[model samples]
Target: MAPTCPSEVQERKILRRSRFGCRNCKLRKLKCDEGKPRCKRCSSFRVLCNFMPNVPDLQPVTDDSSSTFVVQGRAQLQPPLTSAVWTSDASTFYQLDAKCQDFVTRYLGRSLITPDDPNMIKVNRKLLILAFTHPFLMHASLAVALAYDRHLNSSLGCRRTVEECYHRSQSTTLFNRRLGEPIETRDKDTIWGTAAALVILAFSAPDARTPEESWPLKSSDPSDFEWLRMSRGKMSLWSIANPLRQGSLFRAMESTFAEIHSPLPEKGIDGIMRPLATLCHLKDSSTPGNNPYFNAAHAVSQIQDLLDSQVKVGQTELFMRSLHGPFESLLRGKDPVALLLLYLWYRKAGRSIWWIELRARVECPSICSYLRLYHKGYAAVHAFLPGGSLAM
Candidate 1:
C-alpha cells in the first residue's frame, strides 16, 4: 500500500543515508558525501569513495518507542581544487628534518677550521653553508654526494666532496666499483646496496622516528638492522645474521678494504671473511668520525666467525690479516685507546669476558697513555663512540 510513504520525516532519513561518502570516513570526522559519480569530499580530496549497503526490504516502522527517527537537513558540498599527496623526491617532501638541519649547521660552523687538508676545508665550508640553510637536508644530500664520489674513484677517498661521493654512491654500478667491481650493466643487489648505504649514513644520527636514545646499541632484533651501516637495525647479532641476510654489504665493505690495499684474510670463504676482517681493522683504528658500539661489535663478530670457521689458510689469512693492522696499532704500547675500542666491541657484542681478555692483553703504558689521549678528545669527539658513555 502507498502507506503515505511514511510521511516526509521517514523519507528525509532514507535520503540522508543514501547520499555520498562511505560511513567510515564520516564516522572518523572526515569529509564525505553521498553521491553517484563520487562523493563531494572524496572527489575534492582526490580519494576513492564507497557507499553504505542498501537493504531495500528493511523498512522503518512507525514505532514511537524506536530510537530510529529521521530528520531532514540540506547542505551542499563542492569539490575542492587541491588535495594532499606524497612523493619519493626529497625536495618535495615536508619539513621533517628542520631541527636536525639547524643543529648540524651550528655544529659545523663551530668546528670549522683552516685545515691544510684542502678537501676537508672545502667540505667543512660547504657543510657550514648547508647548516645555515638546511641542516637535515644537507646531511642526506652530502651523504649521497660522498657515496657517489667513492663510486667514481676509489682513490678519491672520503673527507673530500663527501656529499658528491654519497650521491653517486646511490648508483649501483658506482657503489659496486667502490668495492673494486667495474660498473656493471645491471645488478639489483648493487642498486639495493647503494640505496641502503645512503639511507644508513644519511639518517643514522638525529632522527625523530628512530631516535638513538630509544634504540638499543646491541639489539638482537632483526628489525633494527641497517644493512647500509653493516649493523643491525634492531635484532641481536645472532638473530640478525641468520634471517636478515646482511652478508652483501659486509662483502662489499670487505672487498672495498682489499680493493683499497688492505690485506685480505687467509681462510674461510673469500666473500664474508675479507669484509669481516676489514671491519675489525677499521674499528680498531683511529679512524675519524664516530664508531658506534653496535657497529664495532658487528665487525668484530664477523671477524671472529671467520677465524672460527674451517677454511683454507690463504682465505683465513685474509681475515687474520685484519688483526695485524689493529694489533700493530695496539703494539705501539703507548696507550689504551686500542683496548678501549676492543672493549667497546666486546661489550656491545655481549662478550664481557672477551672485553676482560682484550683489556688484559694491552700493554699498560700504551693502554694508559692512549686512555689519557682519548680522555682529552673524548669530550669533543666522543660523538664517534655510541651510547654516549662519558668515560672512554
Candidate 2:
C-alpha cells in the first residue's frame, strides 16, 4: 500500500459567502465576488451576473426549554418547534402550526369595513402583513385570535378557559414589554401597531391589577377602580400615538367607535330614554350655568352627530378626543347624571369590544344602585324602566 498523495485528498464542502451567487459561479462551485451590477468573474467571462436577492435573516429553529408542546389525551407530543423566529434585535417570519396559521389567515381575509369603503380592506391587510415583522404586533394579533377563538368555542359549548388564559398571558407579556418602552424612540409603524394591540387587549384581556390583590375595602383608597386605571393607561397610549391618525388602523378604530356611539333611533328605544335625557338636562340647568353635566350631554350629542353623518370617515377620532374633557369632568364631579350618561354611552357603543369590556368591568349595575341611593324620586321611576331602556 502506497501513501496517498496530497493532490489526491478530497476537499471539504464549505458554506458560501453569498447564498445568491451568479449563475455561472454557482454552477462551477466557485466563490462569488458579489459585486454590484456584475461580479469580476462574470465580467471577465462577459456573462450576465444575475445574483439572486438575499434571503431574510432568520435564526434556524432549535430545541430549547421554551419549545411548544401539544397535549393530547394525557400524553404530550414534542412536535418539532414550529413558530416564528423571535429575536431580541428584530422580527423574522418563521412558521406556525396549521390551526394558528389558519386563524391569522382567516382574520386577514375577512372584510374589516363596509362595502362602500373598499380601501380600508387593503389597509387592514397591510397592517396584518406588518404584524409578521413586529413582535408586539405579532403578540397582539395572536392575543386577539386566542380571545376570539375562546369566545367562539365557548358559544359552541367547548370550554378552553385554561389554554386560552395561558396563551393570552404569554401574548400580553410580550405586548406589555414593548408597551413599557419609551414612546418617542419607537418607529411610527410600531407605535401604530401598539395602539391597535392595546385596543384589542383592552377588550380581550381582563383589566390590569395587582396579582392576588382583593377589592379595596374603602372606596376612596384610589386602587378601588383598577379597571378605570387600565382605561386611563390605554388612553395615555393612544395620546402618545396620536400622530398615527392618518393610518388605516386608526380609521378602523374610529369606524368601530362611531358604530358604538351612533344615536339610538328616535322611534323605539329613544322614546324610553327621552324622559331620562330631559331630566338630566333639567338637573344640569339647576346647577350653576357652567354645569359639567351639560358639557357631557353636549359631548354625547356631538358623538351622535358624527355617527349619524353620511361621511363619517375622519370624525370618529376627533369625537373621541373631544370626549376626554366631558369624561374626566363627569368622573371628577361624581354626578349621577354623568354616571348615567356614561352608562348610556357605553350602552350605545355596542361595536367596540373595549366598551363592552368596560361596561362589565365598571359594573353598570353598581353605578345604577349608587345613583338610586343618591337621588330618591327619580330612582322609583328608574326601577320600572323596561329592559334595554336607559335608566337615570
Candidate 3:
C-alpha cells in the first residue's frame, strides 16, 4: 500500500482554536473565547468561573481523580450544544464519566435537589467539587442524585434502584474508614458532605407500601426508625467536622443550622391544639426533658406553625428530631399517645416534603386503622385529622 498526499488536492477545513479555556468552558465543550477575568459563557450561565488570567501551559495534574481534564462527549451531556462529537478515545483521563457530568450539570442547572436557596446551591456546588476529590463522597452524591431522580421519574415505591444501592454501599464502607483514620482539615468537609448525602439516601427510601408494613404499625423490629437513627447519628460528626466554623464551605449554611437546632420551647403545649395537648397529657410542668409525650406533642404543633407561616423547607428534620430519646422509645413501645402524635405529624408534614409523602401516604391511613383496632377510646382525636372517619 502506497501512501499518497492527495488524490485531488483538497482544501483543509480550518477548525476553531479552543482547548486552553477555563474548567467550565472546557466542560461544556465550547470553543473558549479565552476572555480575561471571566469567560462570557460562564458569566452568561451565571456559573462559577475558575478561569485564570495568563495561564501556564497545560500539564498533567498530579491528581487525575478530581481533574476536569477528561473529555466527556456532549452526547452524554444533553441539550445539544454542539454538532460535532468528541472522539471518545482521545480522552485518556478516566474516572469523571459522562453520567457524572450529566447528573451534576443537570442538578445545578435545574435546581433539582435543594431549590430554595442560591446560597445552599453554592455550598453544594463546592461540596460537589469536593466529591470529585473523594471517592466516598462521589458515591454518596450519585446515590442521592439517583434516588431523587427515581423519586421524580419512577412510580411510587420505597425500594431504591440498583445503582442507588451500589453507591450507598460503597460510600458506607469508605466513609467509615475515613472517619476511623486521622483526617486532615481538608478531609473534614468531605466527611460531612458524604454524611449528609448518605442521610438523605436513607430518608429518601423506605421498605414498605402499607402502614401495616411500616414502622410502629408493623411488628416491632430492631430496625424500626433506623432512618431516623442514622440521621440523628450524623450529629456526632458536628464537633469533628465543625461545619459552621469560619472558612468552612458550610458556614454559608449557618441559617440552615439555626433552623435545625432551634431550641425546644420550655412548655410543650405552647402552640399545641387543645385536643392534641390533652391527648399527650400536657401539663403546665411539661417540658421536653421531663414529660415523654411533650416532645412528640411539641413536634406536632410546630407543623401547624409551619403551615400558618407557609414554610416548607427543614420541617421534615424537625419532625424526626422529635422521634429521638423518650419519644422513640414510646413509639417503639407502641404508646397510643406517641402513635397519635406521629399520625398527626405525618398528616401535616406529608404535604411539604416530597419524600415524606412516600411514607406518610401509607402510614397515615395505617395509623387510622391501627387506632381504630387497638385504641378505640382515642377516636375522638379523629376530629383533628382530615380523614378521621376511618379511625371512627
Candidate 4:
C-alpha cells in the first residue's frame, strides 16, 4: 500500500460513482448523465428521456484479488416506462391464439376466390390486423372463418357441430353487442371493420331454414338475407366515416364495389335478357317507369357486365357484388322477372366452383319451389333450373 498511484485511485472513485444508465443511453451504447426529466443525450437529440420503472437498485461486488469491483445488475433491462405497455385483454388473447391467427391468415390469402386484386387483399389484411385490438371485429372475423369452414368441411370429418355452434354463438353475441353500442361511443374504424365482418359472415353462415322446411316466397330464413341487410348497414356506417373514406382501405373497398356493381355492357347478356325484359314489360305495362321489369332489365344488364368483366379478368369474385344496390331488394321481392335474372346470374356465376358449391348446397334447393312455381309453363325457366335446359 506504499505510494498508491493517484490515477488508479481516481479510476476507482469514478467507477464507484457510476450508476445504471437511462434507456436511451443504454440503447445508444453511450454514457448517461441521468438527468431528471431528460437525459443529456436525449435532450441533445430532442427525444423523450425514458428510464426503466421498478428497477432494483444495483449493488457493487467487491473483489479480493483486485482493486476494481464490478457492478452487478440485471443482464437484460426492461423496456422504458414510456414505451407502450401491452396487457392481456380478451381481444388481445383471442388474436394471439395460433388457430385464430392461422384462420385470419388463410382468410386474407384465399377466402374471396377472386383474381387477387392487390387493393382488396391489402384492405382485408389491414382489417384483420386492426381486429386484434377490437374485440367485436375479432369475434366477427373468427365467426366468419368458423362458419365457412363448417360449411365446406363439415361432412369431411371436421370439428363437431356443437363446438362450431358454440364459438359462432359467442362471436355473434359479441358482434350484436357492438352493433347495439351507441354510435357516439364507437370509433369509425371499428364500425367499418364490423361491417366488413358482417359481409363475410353473410357469405359463410348457413340459412336459418331447417332441412325439412321448404323454400317460401321470402324463404323465412334470416341467413339468406342477414348478410344483405348487414351489407347495407355497413355502407350506411361507411358513409358516416368521412375521414376514413380518404384512406387506401376505403378506396380499395369502394373500387371493388364499383367494379362489382358497374353497369353491364349491352352486348354480353342482351341475347338471353331480351326475352326476360319483354316478359317483364308485358307482365306490367301500367306504369312503365315504375315497373319491376324495367328495373330488372337495368339490373340484369349490370349483372351481365359483371360476368363479362370476370371473364376478361379470368376470375370469379364473390357473389355479394351482384347483391348490391337495388338488386338485393329486387331479389327479395320474389318477382318472377327478378328471379329469372338472378337465375341467369347464378348460371354465369356457376362457372366458378365456389358459386357451384353454394348454389347446389345452399341456394338452389332453398329456392326450388319458388322457381318452379314461377316457371310452371315456361320451358326457358325450366332450362335454367338445376337439371333443366341449362348445361350448368
Name the best candidate (by TM-score).
3
> Which runs in model 1 stand beyond 4 Å of their true positions?
1-105, 109-118, 127-220, 227-261, 267-392
Predicted candidate 1 versus true structure: per-residue lDDT over 1-392, tens digit per residue: 01111132121122244334574345323545567545675555433344634311111122221222111112132211234211122121212133224434443333121114344344445443432232223333434433333333443112223223222222222333333534332232333333333443432221112111112211223332222233222112223222123433233234322432333333333332333334334333423233322233333444344332222212322322233333534423322334454443333322222111222222222233334333545442232233333322
lDDT of each: 0.31, 0.45, 0.64, 0.48
Top-scoring candidate (lDDT): 3
**Model 3 residue 130 lDDT?**
69
* Alpha carbon deviation, residue 99, candidate 2 (Å): 4.2
Error of 3 at 244 (Å): 0.6
What digit string (tens of lDDT, one per residue) describes model 3 on residues 1-392? 01112233234344474767786566344667878776786666544455753221121223322333232224242322334211122211124446656776676333344566688878878887766557677767877788777777866444665446555765786678678878779888888888887777766777665455666455666765767777877878999999987789989777767867877677747787777677777878788777888866776677666652354545546667777787887888887778777877776776666556666667676666666566656666655555555331
Look at candidate 1 and tell me the lDDT of residue 126: 44
Q: Is candidate 2 or candidate 4 better by TM-score?
A: 4
Models sorted by TM-score, best on top: 3, 4, 2, 1
Window of ten residues with lowest summed lDDT in model 4: 56-65
Where does the lowest 10-residue lDDT sum fall in candidate 3?
85-94
Model 2 regions more than 4 Å off? 1-95, 111-117, 150-186, 204-278, 281-289, 302-334, 351-362, 369-376, 379-392
CA shift of 315, model 4, Å: 13
TM-score of each predicted structure versus truth: 0.23, 0.52, 0.70, 0.57
Worst 10 residues of 1 by lDDT: 206-215
Q: Kindly provide the TM-score of model 1 when superposed on the true structure, using C-alpha atoms.
A: 0.23
Per model, state how many residue pairs clash: 67, 1, 0, 3
